[model samples]
Target: MSLRYFDNLLKSLYTVARMNEPAKPDWEKIAAMPEFQALLKAKRRFVVPCCIFFTIYYFSLLYLVGWHTEMVKKVVLGHLNIAYLFALSQFFMAWIIAFLYTKKSSKFDQQAAAFLDHAGFKK
Candidate 1:
């Protein structure tokens, strides 16, 4: 019974999360070129650190939620009633991080796109 429910949940997630535009990485072209390769390396460096930061940030929230749920009274705010400022801070930080990532990724992607165009690749 639980297995069937879990399978349906996974299917629902797959359906909703399906990509509208799939990523098309040009690794072959990037690998052949020197500057494009450096751009790839720089992009990776920027991305990996941001990923790690968010990963740790979220993991700490999970840990804190588990640790603090015992002390905070769960209250209803419309639908969710998790009444805790600590939890709210986590959510706020998540939004701030998301905004930062969008800005950062745009900058990096723009730089990378320029480099790729200069390397004889189409945008």
Candidate 2:
């Protein structure tokens, strides 16, 4: 694709990023031997601690933001408020978690696919 098209696509994605909500997890995929459990266990080990830390961090931000919401509202950037940016930072954290998840899941998927192919389940 051309750079302009790619740029437009990226802009569209950014707009979607601002508007999009998180998805619901699939129980059927959890039920399948899709390596999600094992991968999930591995992911969970890292994620759990990170989540705890983030939960604390987030609440602390909430406290501070509440404390300084007025001051923050005054310090604006191109029509955006600090509170919205702070809230958006939380989404960025979630996005980071998701990116890590996708990378790790891709690794698990590669291994699982290889195993499945070797075991005569190639499809």
Candidate 3:
């Protein structure tokens, strides 16, 4: 067969496949729900501040390393410089944030479940 015929066949198959899929949830209704709105608010309350804090922290480290190398070089430990400590602390900071987010997300999950239950969408 020709390339155009093969492309048309694929397009028709894709359309059929999409048509067979189940209906999606009504997001407008979900968004209007109080529980869903609260879940979104909770996420924003945690995430936005955390993101801003981390951005400032990461930039401050960059600024120190870039323009204040002499200060960062001062040894706080036996041989490790302040820069090294700060760099290592970034990893720990990420882990701590992730741990806190995990804890916070459990509450969001409950809120989501409640929304679904209220909406009669729970399976």
lDDT of each: 0.73, 0.72, 0.92
lDDT of candidate 2 over 22-87, digit per residue (tens): 575465754455454555566677668877977986897788687877866755778888777777
lDDT for 93 in candidate 1 is: 80
Tens-place lDDT per residue, model 3, 30-120, is 7888888888899999999999999998899999999999999999999999999999999999999999999999998888888889988
* lDDT string, candidate 1, 1-123, tens digits: 699999999998897777655667677876768776777787788778877887887777677567876544566565555545556777788788788778777877887778878866777
Model 1 residue 6 distance off true place after TM-score fit, in angstroms: 51
TM-score of each prediction: 0.53, 0.43, 0.76
Per-model clash counts, in order, read 1, 0, 0
Better of 2 and 3 by TM-score: 3
Candidate 3 positional error at 7, Å: 18
Q: Which residue pairs clash in candidate 1?
A: 75-81
Per lDDT, the best of the predicted structures is 3
Ranked candidates, highest lDDT first: 3, 1, 2
Name the best candidate (by TM-score). Answer: 3
What value of lDDT does candidate 3 attain over all alpha carbons?
0.92
Clash pairs of candidate 3?
none
Candidate 3 stretches with Cα past 4 Å from truth are 1-26
